[model samples]
Target: MVGAWIWNRNKERVETCSAKAVVLATGGAAKVYQYTTNPDVSSGDGIAMAWRAGCRVANLEFNQFHPTALYHPQARNFLLTEALRGEGAHLKRPDGTRFMPDFDERGELAPRDIVARAIDHEMKRLGVDCMFLDISHKPEAFVRQHFPMIYEKLLGLGIDLTKDPVPVVPAAHYTCGGVMVDDNGRTDVDGLYAIGEVSYTGLHGANRMASNSLLECLVYGWSAAEDITRRLPLAQKVATLPAWDESQVEIPDELVEIPDELVVIQHNWHELRLLMWDYVGLCAPPAGWSAPCGALPCSNRSWMSITPASASRIICWNCAIWCRWRSLSYAARCCVRRAAVCIIPSTIRSRCLTAARRYSRPWLT
Candidate 1:
């Protein structure tokens, strides 16, 4: 059994629940992006918390922007699944001109990266809020039969898919990097396991295919279950752990801060999101990433000075900084590899030595 210490959001009290082991399966961090097909809960709490606990995060450079998400303010992160493109939807300009063929020969069937970039390019060039996806030219009965749910949902939104092209935009959809885990989803911390999107098992290297990622999640879920079951009997014989001590420190009278301080965090939050969306987002170049990369440290310093009352939110800000730092470094490496002639042997040695320190530690116990 795995248990958790739940914190009451209202009363702000910490309560403990215990089990043999603990797992972090808190979904992806798509909420970091301005426009994403993720719920508000997908704010990377697991990734941030695990990193704070000394786990190495990997491959955060590979965030995928799904090619088509509904572009209605009222729809709230609603994804128009890839199956629509599969069943012969055409990406068109507002004037009814098909545009995907100009970007790639595969047209609507191109790989996600190609399609997403094309759509983004068109939107930017045309100065439009969104592009249109049309399948209306197909028989109405066929559209209704194949995509009944989409049809009905769009109808409710006052869109008749049989006549009008659905407005769409590319949105951050999946994160391909997270807590580095092994074949069994075990993290660096003993008795701590991470699975699903929270754990980076190296399955989806650069871009995750829509169908494959779901399959990866299912496979790992079964694998983790089997591994945990096999270890449970031995786990039951372990010595009793000490209970958490509530008296070690005084409880803060408050978690929320004064309005002035709160204003700082809110301002930084808005700036960070817009920076991430515009700079570090899809089509980010190393040079374009410089200003935002520099801003992260400044944001961190400001967030840090805001007092301990908002420590939890500070941790979140730190995590966001870490992700941006890692992404900038990844992009820099790409630029280096493309333009530089040689890698410095000393730098490689230092990186190897640093990696060596964590490699020999106990991962499971």
Candidate 2:
């Protein structure tokens, strides 16, 4: 919490910043999953930094998967918001039969967790890639008027939102757990505050309701600001903070060598994403949880073996991803242990096992 060593992208060098208080608003880690509605920048950097700074992160196992994202190949991460369902869209199978009623009485209007589980269950049971969301029964004018941007986006993607049932699937939407923070957004580390999706304020619990994320951010952002202002007057100022030193850092002689290293890093990134999605994803069963938890330590060791003083920005990012990945694996293991102790009901456990059995492929093992 003393200061930060920042990579100055514009200057192509490292810079140092000393601050009395630091706030992390760096979104969530949805990009850790293969399929997510989050932008590429949501790579869990803030959470990783906080953890590295000795802040305790909690409940990372409760990643909320939104029930419906556009399932087209070109726009796989594009989110089709829940408003469609709120407006009376139906969740249907390939044969155009409704299925949500069988899972929950609220049907398409069920809570996000329930709806996502239902969609995931059906996709596995039918051995299909995706389900359908049909708002075609609603008038074209109504659809266009209410969802103009969605209508336009779908049109460009070659699907008529009003005339056709949009292909949909669950996608990693939000991180409900993060660095544990107090009501004033203070972390375990003094002088550092985490706000927005980066901090776990125990507001969302195991399931985050839609639109509540914004409220958490607004409330915490203001509170953190107020706390920082109150504390800033009494904060001790560092007389002389050391600047970033690259004295012993090794740089590759040949520019050509950098590409090879980058390729390896990219490959590692892909592997990590796939590992998370397959092993620790929505329906992760307790039986196979060890694989991902074990895999991360090797990756962590490998990354650490390479001296970070010589590491490139991408390598540093990959290291951060590994840090978050380890936390995620730990969270998943904790969740499994809790389930074993009967924290989760037998009915829910049975449903999760069924989904896991259906979805897991031989190659995934």
Question: Whose lDDT is greatest here?
Answer: 2
lDDT (CA) for every model shown?
0.66, 0.73
lDDT (tens digit, per residue) of candidate 2 on 83-155: 9999999999999999998877798998876788778777878889899999999999999999999999999
Q: Which digits, one per residue and each the tens of the lDDT, describe model 1 over residues 1-365?
A: 34655554565444566778788888877766667888766667677667667888776546778889899978876888788889899999888898988867798999886687678767877888889999988999999999999899999999998889999988988877788888888888766788888779998876687667788788887888888888887785444544545444332444334345434545555555556666556655334434455554233333333322234343323333333333333332322222222123345222112222322321110
* Per-model TM-score on C-alpha atoms: 0.75, 0.80
Q: Could you tell me the lDDT of residue 100 within candidate 2? A: 91
TM-score of 1: 0.75
RMSD of 2: 5.2
